[model samples]
Target: MVVTMLRLRKAVTNLTQPQFIEGYRKAQLIDVREPKDFEAGHILGARNIPYSQFRQRFKEIRPDKPVYLYDQNGGKSARAALFLRKKGYGQLFHLQGGFRLWTGKVKSK
Candidate 1:
């Protein structure tokens, strides 16, 4: 389990706010926070695929594209990235400080 966790950590890249902002537009932006949090405020264009349901819905994200994951902070995104890596999805990245640190524009439902 430890070995697998290490491998997953290395497989996903952690991007700073600026870097995330720079690349997220071209990647598949995913918000792993719960639906309530996602609906309150989320990065513009991000799709809510809450970590609680990630396993069942990860396939909704295309493997052909880069995947950017984030939550209120970074923990959930990190785990989500690990799950995606194990599932053979590459081009995985996450916001270093997650959504709360994001100074970029957001959309609320």
Candidate 2:
């Protein structure tokens, strides 16, 4: 991602699966994995904003709403949260274990 904004060390909330499932309906659920990974299987209703495309597509996610993010593991989502926080996004949350550990329903193409 481009480094055009201030790099802030803002803390993003890490949610367990139960907590994530509880609030994701009211937030923007973003899957930060690559498209292929997203296409294979992802949380139901999640929007794809792959880490590779985050710099260009992040604006598509509303900064006003809470954002819930995840990747194959927690790493990419954590990075995406850092990037989004730098861009002035305040309400950030990520699945603690990410998609690989998600026990909820998923959508596969």
Error (Å) of candidate 1 at residue 108 is: 0.9
Model 1 is weakest, by summed lDDT over 10 consecutive residues, at 2-11
Residue runs of model 2 more than 4 Å from their true location after superposition: 1-9
* Models, CA RMSD each: 1.7, 4.2
Worst 10 residues of 2 by lDDT: 1-10
- Clash-forming residue pairs, model 1: none
lDDT by residue for model 2 (1-63), tens: 434223323458889999999999999999999889989999999999989999999999999
Model 2 TM-score, 2 decimals: 0.90
Clashing pairs in 2: none
Give one clash count per candidate, in the order shown: 0, 0
Would you list the C-alpha lDDT of every candidate in the order shown?
0.91, 0.89
Q: Which candidate number would show the highest lDDT if scored against the true structure? A: 1
